[model samples]
Target: MSAGGAHLKDEGTRRQVVLAGGAAGLISRFCVAPLDVVKIRLQLQVHSLSDPPSHGSAAGPVYKGTWSTMRAIVRQEGITGLWKGNIPAEMMYVCYGAIQFTAYRSTTEALAQLDPHRLPPSAESFISGAVGGGMATGATYPLDLLRTRFAAQGTERIYRSLGGSILEIARHEGVPGFFRGCSAAITQIVPYMGLFFATYESLRPITTQWEQLPFGTSDAAAGVVASVLAKTGVFPLDLVRKRLQVQGPTRTRYVHRNIPEYRGVLDTIGTILRTQGPRGLYRGLTVSLFKAAPASAVTMWTYEHVLRLVQEMELAAEA
Candidate 1:
């Protein structure tokens, strides 16, 4: 989610970068929490998103589409259901943003020093993005798993509280449970981030030529396009990660659904293809794009503005 960081020529500016990164993440998460909840539910459902409820049909889906799923969640679990995993999600985003931006900046510097002439700018951006995104995803993966489990559950709650969920995973599934889908997550995130930063950087200059776009700046517009493209490219892996996160002894806790047990990433893909067809891999794609576009745009725009503000404050103090 990081586009990069402000120039870190000094320790003071470095600190500002971290602060701006965290603020950007919190703001973005708040804007897209509901969309995130819908996307997760759609991804985890075994039945197709369009399938309506039917007593006779075992394959009947509880969630029909983005709006329908939102309505169903409200009907079954109240309006707050849309923010079921907000706590961990916010925490994860904050940590992810800080780590991602710092890592991206550091990695980019390292790459520049390592082979500035050999590596192209796009390749550097791609590599740096991959490293940064991977670090953020790995560090915050437990929280991510918890967020998914929370969002995946319905009125029939599985693990009540965050601490309880942590203990439950530790006790039943052992430590590895926390990272059930980490492989798929990292696999998806690496390329996703690389593609995002590369695409955004490539498009930013061209988009800036417009100059009159009202919503934000060219950076934000580029971010929106980049995120949508990246999310679409690696969407199946994202679905696999969500499905894996909900697996374990509590798999059946989801209401009005029958979740199958998957041995691993490949098995999960196979099951989805066998049961729901190719579309299953992209079950929640529409909602995901809805989330990705605005989330990335907001993050990029906020990060740039906040970084400028923070750096200005730092300069004021020094002066």
Candidate 2:
């Protein structure tokens, strides 16, 4: 192919990847939104420091199975509660996937030009994924906080709309409050994206060759693997981020009542450990894993397939 043709092909592929990833992400989001709601509730549920007997006990009514949790939430809050914060969560994930994947591809391309031989495809993909995830999370972290809070609300206290929730958070906590868990988010994203892309890219060749799958199939498979690894690897950080974000306005009462207080990520972690013990840090691992596993699989699969279809259509148009 001519240089121009090659450029066109790359551009088309990039566009396809974005569309595919986005579609997959959207599907995944809808499928897992209920579980996500449960996860948020688990993360945000408060136990008094004075109630040391129940601290870190997984015996609570809320900490039961998914079906039980769902039933309780619906019974307590109504059907609409299951979809709380759906809009913001969907929007945030879409933007996050788009920005992260686009930036990753673009970054890889640029880096390849600088040192084609030294910068292997895997390395490029890893670096790009990390940078992209970080950038995406950073840009959308505030919305993430909003989504968590909105999702974590009691059924009776649920916001009428996304805007209403945002306004309420702002009014009660101020603008800076929206970024409550940003530090933990960034920490989680860096390693999560790094491992995610690294694992996906590393496995792509084997999956493609052994399975004889289409290009997108291999990509999607890679996404599942990467998501599992990354989520597991940074599970603790995710726990901390959730705790910080969902603490609500009364930090002094809910988080800690001591002199120093839970001002930041470290303090929050320390508080969780001292008060709730190790189990507190792994609060909703079950639901999170259940939601995340298939969510990641579907997201990557959809993203890659969508991108491939788009590319084929574009190619046919050119012909």
Candidate 3:
């Protein structure tokens, strides 16, 4: 291929990769958000002691299955409740996924150029994924907090819109409230992203070689496999973060109608362990797994195909 042709091809590939990643992210979030709602409620219930009158259920909150939770949320809150913070959630996923994909591809390319023989190990992918997740989560955490609150509220009140909800949170809790779960979010998301990329990159080649699939096909397949593996590893942290975000001062009352209450992430984890045990930490794993598998598979597949199409279109335009 001519130099100019090669340049065009490279640009097309880059565009395709970006589009694919963004699409995957968007789809994954939408698909799994309902399960996400369930997870949040399960986490929050651990801390729901304070709002005794409002929240009810002192017997440590009944452990409903995912379907039951979904049914209850829908019956109590309506269709809108299931979606909760959908707008911001979608935006976060799109932006985060796009940046993540771009970063991963660029990093992989650079590393490959540096040491072609040395494939990216889990550690390297972990670091890269961690950086991407941290950056993305940090940028979008405020929105995440809002989504959690809205979902947790359970149709008791109405906000005029997303802006109204933000205003309410700001007025009630001040600026810091928006960042309530930030530390835990970063902790959870960073490793989740890192491990995801690392595992996917490391495994893609092996899986592809063993399966004898095309080169890029392995990368796409790897994305799905890696997502599941990483999610399983980091799900507990996610449970913690959601709990911290949604629990609020109300959670303290649940912990101890007195005793100064639990403060911050460590306190909450310790309390849950004392009261609830390991099962407390993994309330929604089943639903999460169900949602995650197809979500990841579809996301990665869509992203790859989208990129391919975009590249083809770009090349055709040039031709």
Candidate 4:
């Protein structure tokens, strides 16, 4: 390849794949932001609707299941309430997904050059995904905090805008507050992403060869399966992460505490187990699954399609 050809090849490098992945993540997230809002609220409720109302319940706790939550949000705050934090939430997830794919692709490409024979394709996929998710979590954690806070905002409207919320968090908890639950996030997301890529990649041949479908179709099918598996496995850690990040003086269940609300990750885990049992850790599992299944399919398909198109264009230009 000539110098110009090499440069053109760089256009389709893993770094640029981040752009395609980000676009895919953004559109997929927008498709399911409302479901995400419901999932976050449900996770933050502090009490289980499955059990009878108790002291820790969110006031009357009228919002119970996913359907009831959507209905209550619509009834109390209008249809728009269901999508209150759509912008920030989409932005956060988009960046997260983009960074994830970028790191995954980059890591795999780099590793293949070093020790291609030692690690199988499935193992490579898992490692790349794990690294990608951890890096993305660390890089975009503050945005995660803001997005969660935005989604958690309900009828009381404690947080009027994104800037106001950031200022308040900075004032109260300082810069570190932005990364409160980062450890939990990384812990959960690392393995979650690892299994996701492993499963998806492993299924590729099954869908493409056995089913004789197109590449995008195979990946979408695989993505749905990966999504369900990853979400279900790490849901408890996700609940803990949300609880740690969302502490504040609000009318909701996450009312601010004068002191450090949760001692640490384990303490938070134990508290939930004691208070709400296993069910507590899975507060919004239903809504999350509902959102994840389609979101994963769409995101995978879109990413595959977009990346292929971009690479094709790059190749054509080089030609």
Give TM-scores for every candidate, taking all chains together and pairing residue i with residue i.
Answer: 0.93, 0.83, 0.80, 0.87
Give the per-residue lDDT digits (tens) of candidate 3, residues 33-70. Answer: 88777766655665332323323445445335678678
TM-score of 3: 0.80
Across residues 1-319, which tens digit of lDDT does each residue of candidate 1 receive? Answer: 1223222223235677789889999999999999999999888878765567644244687777899889888987899999999999999999999999889878877875653254666887799899999999999999999999899888777889999989989999999999999999999999999999888878877887986987558879999999999999999999999999888888877754688989899999998999889998998999999999999999988988888889888779999
What does candidate 4's lDDT look like per residue over 63-119, in tens digits?
568997788778877888878777777778788878888888778767666532446
RMSD of each: 3.5, 4.8, 5.6, 4.8
Model 4 clash pairs are: 248-256
lDDT of 2 by residue, 1-319 (tens): 5332232125356667677657766788888899898877666544422333332243332335567678877887788778888899899888887787788777776775673244655666678788989999998898798777677666345467778878887898888788988989999998889888888778766777756665447766777778887888788788788777766554333211221235678887888888778777777777888877778777777766677778889889999
Off by over 4 Å in 2: 1-17, 46-61, 210-218, 250-261
Position 259, candidate 3: lDDT:
20
RMSD of 1: 3.5
TM-score of 2: 0.83
Evaluation by lDDT, superior candidate among 3 and 4: 4
Between candidates 1 and 3, which one is better according to TM-score?
1
> Residue 25 of model 1: what lDDT?
97
User: Global lDDT for candidate 1?
Assistant: 0.87
lDDT, ranked from best to worst:
1, 4, 2, 3
* Of 2 and 4, the candidate ranking higher by lDDT: 4
**What C-alpha lDDT values do all the predictions have?**
0.87, 0.72, 0.68, 0.77
Specify the poorest-scoring 10-residue window by lDDT in model 2.
Answer: 251-260
